[model samples]
Target: MTDNQGAWTLGCYGNPDIRTPNINQMAAEGIRFTHALSSNPVCSPTRATFLTGLIPSQHGVHSFLDPKYMMGPEAYNTLQEFTSLGEVLHAAGYTCGLSGKWHLGANMTPSEGFTTWTTKPDGSTQEFYDQKVIENGQMRVEAGYTTDFWTRKGIEFIQACKERPFFLFLAYNGPYSLGKLMLNEARNRHAAFYADKPLHSFPRDAMHPWQHDNKAFHNTDAARRRMASEVSGVDDGVGEILTALKANGLDDNTLVVYASDQGWMGGQNGMWGMGDHFRPIGAHELMMQIPFIFRQPGAIPPGQTCDALVSNYDFMPSVLAHLGLGDKMPQQPKSPGRDFSPALRGQPLAGWDNTVFYEMETTRAIRTERWKYVARIPSGPTELYDMQADPQERFNLFGQPGTEETTTDLSKELEAFFDEYADPKYDIWHGGGSKAKRHAP
Candidate 1:
């Protein structure tokens, strides 16, 4: 369940109300992170950060695959020096297997240390397909729903490696569709349950320009229902994996992590998904703040909740620490994530920092224990919020008199972080800025 980097869209950590009884049950038994964040807002970039434990700028895959046209050949490649979590685990005598989406690169190769892999093609537009599984280094196609097939493959891999330790990455692609089949089901169910009441409505706080102009998936009850159904589907997939683990007697010994690639707006802040036409704004907690949970009954204490400021980059180190292989993992030059093993064990993390930073295409934000500071480009002003009073981020307090000192201090910290770890490749690609420009193709 290692969410990898998906934000609140998965309904696990960020959005507590999403139908995720399985994950909720896990959280009830284990800890649910209240303020964990991803280093980047986009998929490939954040995933790169997740694997390398470095920021997006440092990992160099700032945006998704740009193809060979405008950016040149190097733009299509992943970072050269950064090591992945799979590589580390494989090196430490663990059998590694990956199933489902492998957006890091469309071309499936052996560079990612996945000894066995069943991956979707790069930039795949198909929502469901018969995937090819790599068994003992041989590829073969298997048919089923994408999530179900990946779960089957993961279970098979576990059975094959039952005699030894293994790391199985079951990455699923669900609930991201813009289609209506699943949504219709949910709508019908809701209608049958509460026919008299007005259809339950979601709040529309701030609308992106596209959402304001479009009537398709933006402001429709169908869209909301569809999103809810998709979330439930993903949760169901998680439950399937959990069931398989318990059936095979691997539930207590294995460390399960559930997360998403990045957060989606889901019409909350007037956007549908992550990183489209809208300028990346760290406005809502749903975007930057993601869910992170760990479950290992004996190794990690049950019924724990940690309020530490963790990030996607922390995942690699945290897993390594849990497996007692931290010292054997590769060293990164500048990784901001710390091992939260103590917090997972229900011990007090007294000296842990309470601030987490999030950087997107042209936006940068710093979230402290109580305050959130965000700055966007193209004449957009910085935003500040008192999270304790306004958890939904309805109020912006930047430049206000009451929080001047806090803003100033956080701004300095943000600048220092960028100075140390800002990605040089991103700076070069975007002409020293992370802003997107309109140029004739």
Candidate 2:
């Protein structure tokens, strides 16, 4: 996954501005989810949701794992609460290796059934190339471009386990940094690619909450260029991995899936670098909606696109079905996500709901194909937008005479959807008012 990244508005999805040949090639050779969303719009929470087919509330990874959010090692619930992709697949005899960005805590040691583990500490980047990675619980600084390094490790794992099925969670830490600084090698290659590109024009009332976070905060011309450069570096890494897959004759058999954690606010809404859940910006569609591509050669049809709504949580169940281990998942509460395999096959499953739900901290929002409603607790300054018209969410139509019925209905659905989790804290209406303090497990 391209952690802290976006693919929707990129050249791969529709935008012709950005050049991502490898990402575009992946889509051309496989299926792309047009309406895919990160369950939670933060790194760790969304990553946790990717591993466990549950939202942040269920998985107990409410935000990025760090001192600002979690207190200690025991605070992370990745091990105790839900089944992880690694655990389930590893148990099923599939070799599972996680190479980068284990933001769910316990970074040094293997957890969640990953026998082959390597990652760095939370929120520490000693520069993109020179960052320290913990390999098999051993700490060492890795040299060279980080994006390339992870891909190299991924190739090694693939080569080592060529005789068997393996799940390689290659989370690229590039294309997501928060500053103009980049590894010299990566910067040299990408520094001038976007020199002629224009700066993003922001909305008049756009939310620019932080000025110091320049990398993505204001998204100046320099920032955008750097962001694009980083993306190119990641693209090169992907191309390398793809090359290795083909060279090892694992291209057709291996389902190469690529996605990212969440979209950054790079110059959008006059904000940069912050995820949508950050205050004032609320849960914007740009922040939650991410680029999701799945490539399986003859398995998944090529050059196809699925617009049906899917989330990071849907990946686990889908993978289970793909591996013929669907029934192995312990029966618990009904899963929040559907097996989108049908969508991948261009077969529309029954009851295809194209609605999207988003939540972070005290904010909750529901977005339909044409409309979106955002409310933040007791006093949120509710927001409603006709997405068909105000795709940018520039205009708010909440409390307007014509929106009363739709607003009421969507509000109820949003509240009920949250209530289905059985956790009052996320109920959107009653959760915050519960007698017991609302804290994730």
Candidate 3:
């Protein structure tokens, strides 16, 4: 999984410029979901949901973890209280390994039942070269590019454990596509390819009114090139990993799930970064929609695209069901995700609700087939968008004459859903604290 990327950044997703042929090939040879979205719009929270199948409220991680609390005396595993994908798989007799960006905290040592861990010291990246990484409980700066290091480590782990059933969380931190780190010229091999071309894929529109972060780099040519370069670099890594899998004769049976932790906006809606870059925080489609592809050669049908609404929250349940480990799914703190494995095999999902919910701190949203309702805790600034007519979210229909009924219905459903799943101790709407840094107003 990539740090910050949009499905629109790949050629298979209709991106005209970005060089992501390897990922595009995965789309061509697998089941791609057009409406798969992240449950949260930020990094750490979404990653947490992807691993545990829990929302931010239930898991207690509402924002990106602070670096100061990631290691040394203060360091603690954020997901210690709950069971994660690695732990579940490990218990099912699979050797689990993580190759990059284990940003859930306690970075200095392996946590969550992962036997082989080589990860970054923190979540954010300032440089791709000579960066600090923690491997086998030791921290050191890598001499080569960070993306390649992770890729190489992932291949090595697969090779070493191919004799047994193994699960590799090959998390790539590249194509981060935000922060001060992107202002510098990309040092990867793909840098030269994008240096000359005008990357029209990254819109250079006027900044949005709510965009309060990463203002300096918005609409700049250097930043655009850097984003494209990093994305292509990740694509290169994907190619290498795929080749390694086939070379080891694990390609046919191994399920290759390609996805990003969350979505990123590169000047979309005139916003430069994610939902947190805004004052009230935005849940625009670009910030929520992600590339979700699954390939297992014989299991999933090739070249099939499903528009059934799905979220990162559903990933754990779906994978568990796919692996025939449905009986092993956590029951204590029930995950809201439903099994969408039927869709993977080109079969219709019976009783599947075509709706997905999103939460980021005080902001919460519900999206159905035709409408999107966004509600904020405490007082005001709620929004309702007619997704069918205005998918770009150009106008807010909240309190508008004809939208009142739709808004009210959506609001009630949103409330009821959260009421069922949200843990009161971590639900911001109920005055609860988050595990990570809170962005509540």
RMSD of each: 4.5, 3.6, 0.9
**Ranking of models by TM-score:** 3, 2, 1
User: After aligning candidate 1 to the native by TM-score, how far in Å is the CA of 220 from where it should be?
Assistant: 1.5
Cα lDDT of model 3 overall?
0.91
Model 2 has an lDDT value of 0.70
Query: Which pairs of residues clash in candidate 2, taking residues 3 or more apart in a chain or in different chains?
Result: 216-272, 216-273, 217-272, 424-431
Ordered list by lDDT, greatest first? 3, 2, 1
* Number of the top-ranking candidate, with TM-score as the measure: 3
Give lDDT tens digits, candidate 1, residues 1-441. 332224554444545445678777877767788777776655666767777787766665555554331123433336456677888888878889887665665334545677777765543223444654444444566565555676777778888887788888777765554433423444322223332322233445456653422235665666565555556656776777788778888888988887766665666656655543344344456666667777877877777878787888787777788788888556665677678777888888778888777776566778888988887665656889998999877778888787889888988998787777675655432445322222111
Note the clash tally of each candidate. 16, 4, 0
User: For candidate 3, lDDT tens digit of each residue in 1-441?
Assistant: 999898889898889999999999999999999999999988899999999999999999999998877887888999999999999999999999999998888998888989999999999988899999999889999999999999999999999998999999999998898778788999999988898988888887888998888898778988889989999999999999999999999998899999999988988778877888888888899899899999989999899999999999999999999999988889869899889999999999898898999999889999999999999877758999988899989899898898778888999999999999999999899888898997758
The lDDT of each candidate is: 0.64, 0.70, 0.91
Off by over 4 Å in 2: 67-77, 124-126, 179-188, 199-219, 422-441
TM-scores for every predicted model: 0.84, 0.89, 0.99
Give candidate 1's error at residue 60 in angstroms.
Answer: 1.0
